[model samples]
Target: MYIDLAATPDFKRSLFNAIVAPRPIGWISTVSASGRVNLAPFSHFNLVSTAPPVVMFACNAPDDRHEKDTIVNVRETGQFVTNLVTWDLREPMNTSSFNAPYGVDEFELAGLEKAASVKVRPPRVAASPASMECELLQIIDIDPVGPGDTFSNVVLGRVVALHMDDRFVDAGGRFDVVRTRPLTRLGGNQYASTGELVELGRPNPPR
Candidate 1:
């Protein structure tokens, strides 16, 4: 059956979401100007570059109540930490996604402790397998075609520091991806994890 986003669903669902397949979740943590910390998960996130080590996450339109706490705090402080969500921390990661009031601290809400970040004001998750401390580079707010500045906000950050769990590091000092078991979002209400490894050597350039 063919679905039309322009008319049928009334812009409720977009085929782009499911067709994109699995996406990385940026488990972001930010601190308010008043010292409150907000932790939330943004599935619309990924590392954009490796040279300067930049990461980005996109926050969609705000709810009727107010703007999301994560976006608000990041704007106020200009710093945020991206914590890796392992399979073990899935419950707390989901718990942090709850929509709470502005000053509420999601770290405590999820029963997690805050670890001090060396280069940023926001703290990292104490139990996370890895984390990236970042400084805000830019925030691009996509203008909505209609009304409101509520389309989407894209935030880019330059990684200033990194934290890794020693156990996940191999003998050669390389981080083990399969062992980390990073949690990822799938279509609908589905989720996935890195189970097996698939290695393929790139083909040589055509003559």
Candidate 2:
């Protein structure tokens, strides 16, 4: 079966997202300048750099009038928090993804406890396995691919502080990924869990 994207662009777009498989969920928390807190998830996110410790998340608006709360909040306040989602917090993480009004706080809506971030105004999810406090470095506007203008705002932030639960630390001095069971976005309404472990080492060139 072959499908040409030009003939069915929307379906192919969704199909490609599903094919990508197991993308990390950036459970982002942010605060409005007026102090309202918001939490949302972006599968289109990852650590872009490590030297200065930078992270990036993209917020896509449904339309021109509806800007994602996380994007607006980060732009308005210049701060955000990336809370790592785990199996225990899966339900709350999903709850926070609901499309509610801008002012509605997902923390309260999802019944999640909030912890103050050391370097950012946005609070972190207390139940999350780990969190990173970020200061907004820049926001890049992405050009649209289709018809009118499907815009997404990409935010690059510098991590100022990090929080990790000592419980996840093992005797080997490594964060235990198996125990955390982090949540991953699969595609449309689907999600995945951290399953088996596979270790691979870098290949060396012939001497």
Candidate 3:
């Protein structure tokens, strides 16, 4: 059956996210000017460009709370880190998703180890297989359209440094996907991991 998004689908839950399939999860960490730390995971995230190494994530305000610690810290300090969550660290990563107080340290709360980032105030997750330190490039507020009238702020950051576990790297200096086993968010309360790899080449070649 065909249903317009404006009409709203009568399913168990909104199938939009599920229909989009597995999405990369971004485990973001930030530190306030006063040294408070915060961490949260977002599935609405992806790498935008590679020339200068840029990534972005969408942060939707919960209820009427206009300011989350992550957004506030990034805005105040202009820096944050995106830590890659693997299947092994899934539990701790999930713990960081809780809505805690502004000054609450998620690392301590989640019982996870933190490693200082070389270029950012926010610490990276020591358990994560990889992490990227970035500086805020832009933050755009998306206006509500129709239906539930939902909106979110898209935060773009430029990567300045990256840390990766040696175990995930091959002798050729390539990242071994199987070793990384990055965790991804599926629809609803589901999650997935990278399965296989396939390569495709151009059908036509220039003479």
Residue pairs in steric clash, candidate 3? none
* Model 1: per-residue Cα lDDT at residue 196: 68
Winner on TM-score between 1 and 2 is: 2
Window of ten residues with lowest summed lDDT in model 2: 4-13
lDDT for each residue of candidate 1 in 160-191, tens digit (9 for 90 to 100): 99999999999999999898899998887778
Candidate 1 Cα outliers beyond 4 Å, as residue runs: 1-14, 146-150
lDDT of 2 at 88: 79
Pairs that collide in candidate 2 are none
TM-score of 3: 0.92
Q: Count the backbone clashes (under 3 Å) in each candidate.
A: 0, 0, 0
Model 2 agreement with the true structure over 15-88: per-residue lDDT tens digits: 65788888899999999999888999889889999999999988678653557888889879999999999877
Q: What TM-score would each prediction reach against the true structure?
A: 0.92, 0.92, 0.92
Q: List model 3 lDDT by residue over 1-207, tens digit each.
A: 876666763433447689877999999999999999899999889999999899999867777477677888989999999999998889998898888877899999899988999988999999888999999999998887765655678999999999999988999999888878889998988998988778798688778
Residue 79 miss distance in model 3 (angstroms): 0.6
